[model samples]
Target: MRRRVPNEVGIAAVVVLVAIVLSVLSPNFRTIENAQVLLLNGAVIAFLALGQTFVLLTGGIDLSTGSNIALTGMIAALATSAGLPWYVAVIAAIAIGLVVGSLNGSLIAYLKLPPFIVTFATFGVAASIPLILTGASSVNVRDPFFAIIGRGALFGIPMPVVLVAVAAIVFSVVLRFTSTGVHIYAVGGNAETSRLAGVRSARVIVLAYALSGLCAAMGGLIVTSRLMVGYPSAGSGNELFYSIAAAVVGGVSLFGGIGSIGGALLGAMLIATVSNGMNVIGVESYWQPLVIGVIILVGVVLDTHRRRISLATLLSRFRGPREAAAAAPTS
Candidate 1:
């Protein structure tokens, strides 16, 4: 059973190894303060990655996630400034996320548009929102109560990390134990076959993108809360990491319908660890982008390998069944 380690294992192992290496290289890396910082930084990315997993499982992508985050975050901040109740402002953020996500879903599923084009288009829309809302200025959320939601600690555990843990657990349970999860995988694996087999492939695709939107919103909230402000460009460039790294590293099939929640978390942690470690090590800030690019490329190669293996395995299963039929005695 343990002979062939799963591809997820590679991601998990690498995440752990990177954390350890970072710890060793920097004295501050092992401190409790650093743990909190890393966790806070990690939470939003993980949340977005969770959303990306859904779209990816359907053989789709959400380039708009980062922009969605910025837009949502900005809205939440603006609402708070307008004297809305803190909880109400938060709800507004989520509602915006749902609306944007559902829009992407509608276009892809109902209109039969390519997921790529639909999401890519929304990406521009999402990105533009912050600019319009901010008028090119960042919005700061300073209400003590609202600020607590973003930066406050509870019993020594950072709230952001807790939020991430909850999101992951819920997402994992839904994906592994619900019909909707199966629908997502089916649609991604083979839309025509799944549709013919009575699965609602189009609905699944729509739902996947909607889920992606929700995840991006949650991530945006995390960013807004942590920074106590929403920058016009908050979460910019994050989709580059979220879409490819989370899906690829988490064992989510690039072609659709395969993934594990734990793997996605591992992937997020790995990226966070690297970025944080590099910051602590005094590496030139400009060089981080190059390192990230290389890492993403490696993940893409691994994803391709996973797809090939899945295809080969399915073929073998088909061949085995045929061989059994051929060996049966004629009646």
Candidate 2:
């Protein structure tokens, strides 16, 4: 009987390979400053990736992350502009995220709607938030406190990067050591089985989306702080890439019940590397999307192969069990 493929190992190898290739392609890609920039650029998406890890763990996807980023960023900026304390503005932004997440969860959990459709509808509304709030204008956040909160670094690390690291640590602890994490994986792995085992499938499902919303909110805030301005189209169409990259790269099974936060971070970093390398090599902006699409396709293919290899191994292992039973333990 064959053994299950080591998906994590395979993915890590790919990440390493990509990094090496990019380093070879662009001499500066291996430098510390560029490395920081890559991570800085990916901070928001990394936040999205981390949050998406939760949702995906429960066998779900979130399309509204980009939109949520837009909404929260603008809202926070406006709050800061209104003389709100920096901390207060941050809290308000988180509240907005909670509301948006709760709304998404409530509809799906209580109302029994499909997550994709619900998120899609919310995605549309969220995509319009900056426009609704600012009439398609950019809102600048000039509060020194606010700016420092996002742009400032501690011990030479970017604020957003530090936050992402913290979030990853927390999520890793939660997903690896908590009962809620088990329930989440169970619900995603098999809803019927999870319910039969007394897990609150509904709550888990809803909570997953809520967490996803918060992630997007965090991402938005980071981007806003970095840019110091909120654009209506700030996060337009970013959800697709963020979701796919994290899940595929992190070994978070699209089939659910399997993945690690560390893997998700690596996934985000890999995508960030690609974007950073392309820029360093002076690839035209227009071709960036094309490259992203191809990379995504490669991820998908890896996922496909991982699944096939795993299933084949499993089947091979089981084939002997049936054969043994049929042959009987006559010895």
Candidate 3:
């Protein structure tokens, strides 16, 4: 078998290549301000991608993330408009995610429903909820505190970027060092095996979904703060597609049991770079979807190949030196 580049390294190379190409194509793209914008833009998707990574790790998917964002953003906006404190609105928004995630976890864990179908159905229900509550109108957020979460800068870095970094650090620790993290991987790798080993598959699955929801809530809040408005269609379809794509591209396997938050962030950066570059270069809006689709297709193909390579490597290790000597010719 040919030597293969590590997933993160390959992705990082792609990021660098894309940045170079964009820099050449658009003189403005190389500026520090633009770099800041790229990071900020990527941060929102990165947040959702991180959550998706957790769910995907458990061999599950959360199709409602975007819808959850819409619902939570609307809740935050409405709360602030009703004279509630900004912090309180923020809490309320996150609560919406927790409730939705808990519901999804309960149904999937207890009822034995397919994760795909459960999340898919919830996507529809969650998307419609914001409209029901707001009568399909956009609610503007006038709170300065709410605005700061999106626009404020700390130590010369955007708030959104800082939050994303902090989240990545926390998740890295959780997934790498904690027993719950190991159990999550175990469940995704093989539920029966994990159960036999005394891991509570149901609770782990629930926790994964709950974390996904919390991430969605955080994403929605930042979006609302940035736009200074709570529109039911805010995250729209982008949340579901981008989050999953970023995670997958970052090295999170669709089949589950393998991936990292850092990888997902790199994936988000790649996608964000493409988007911002295309916009800066004045690519037609109609072609954007096609480009994103093609990139995702390529990423999926790469992931498949990576899996094959892993399997081959494992099988080769099992074929010991004695077997190899037996197969060799005596010259």
For each candidate, what TM-score against the reference? 0.92, 0.92, 0.93
Candidate 1, TM-score vs. the true structure?
0.92
lDDT of each: 0.82, 0.81, 0.90
Query: After superposing candidate 3, which stretches have Cα over 4 Å from the reference?
Result: 1-5, 319-331
Please tell me which predicted candidate would have the highest TM-score against the true structure.
3
Name the 10 consecutive residues with the lowest summed lDDT in model 2: 237-246
Residue 261 in model 1: shift from native, Å?
1.1
With candidate 3 superimposed using the best TM-score fit, by how many Å does residue 172's alpha carbon deviate from the native?
0.3
TM-score of 3: 0.93
In Å, residue 287's CA in model 3 sits off its true spot by 1.7
Clashing residue pairs in candidate 3, if any? none
What's the CA error at residue 55 for candidate 2, in Å?
1.2
Segments in model 1 whose C-alpha atoms lie over 4 Å from true places: 1-6, 320-331
| Model 2 clashes, total count | 0
